[model samples]
Target: VSVQLYANYAIGKDVQAMKAVVGEEALSSEDLLYLEFLDKFERKFVAQGAYD
Candidate 1:
């Protein structure tokens, strides 16, 4: 659980850093899709109590 949380937190920080460096206008379709995938995966993970 701690590992997953840390990984998510790290990914979030990386995304924020990327946005800060490149700006939101620079985000590509692939980046949007990747973010969507992460959202769905997180939702499913929570719904299924995967961390537990």
Candidate 2:
């Protein structure tokens, strides 16, 4: 459930939203891994849309 929410926000390019959703919890190492992915994904996502 949380992962789904994180993915949605990440794909939507909403880093703040993703952070807000996940920041309240005590993140596990696995969750940290996903956050790193989110950072990269958001960067790529914005870059891909920059020309549009």
Candidate 3:
């Protein structure tokens, strides 16, 4: 499982810096879906105690 705080920070950082630099205008439909998927995945990761 992934560390919850670390995962949250990583996602936030990606959206803020990397996404902005890429000039992504806005989140694509796939990006939104991926974010949701990541959310669920991260939750499971935490629950599974695989997070560090």
Which residue pairs overlap in candidate 1's backbone? none
Least accurate stretch of 10 residues (summed lDDT) in model 3?
12-21
State the lDDT of candidate 2 residue by residue for 1-42, as single tens digits.
Answer: 768856665654444455577772655656566666766656
Winning model by lDDT: 1
Best by TM-score: 1
Encode model 3's per-residue lDDT on 1-52: one tens digit a residue. 4476566546755665555666555777656555666566556654585455
Q: Which stretches of candidate 2 lie over 4 Å from their true place?
A: 1-25, 49-52
Better of 1 and 3 by TM-score: 1
Q: How many backbone clashes does candidate 2 have?
A: 0
Residues 1-52, candidate 1, lDDT per residue (tens digit)?
8788657655655665687889867987766555565566567655586456
Model 1 poorest ten-residue lDDT run: 30-39
Instruction: After the best TM-score superposition of candidate 1, give how far the Cα of residue 30 lies from its true spot, in angstroms.
Output: 0.6
* Model 3 stretches astray by more than 4 angstroms: 1-25, 50-52
Preferred candidate (lDDT higher): 1 or 2: 1
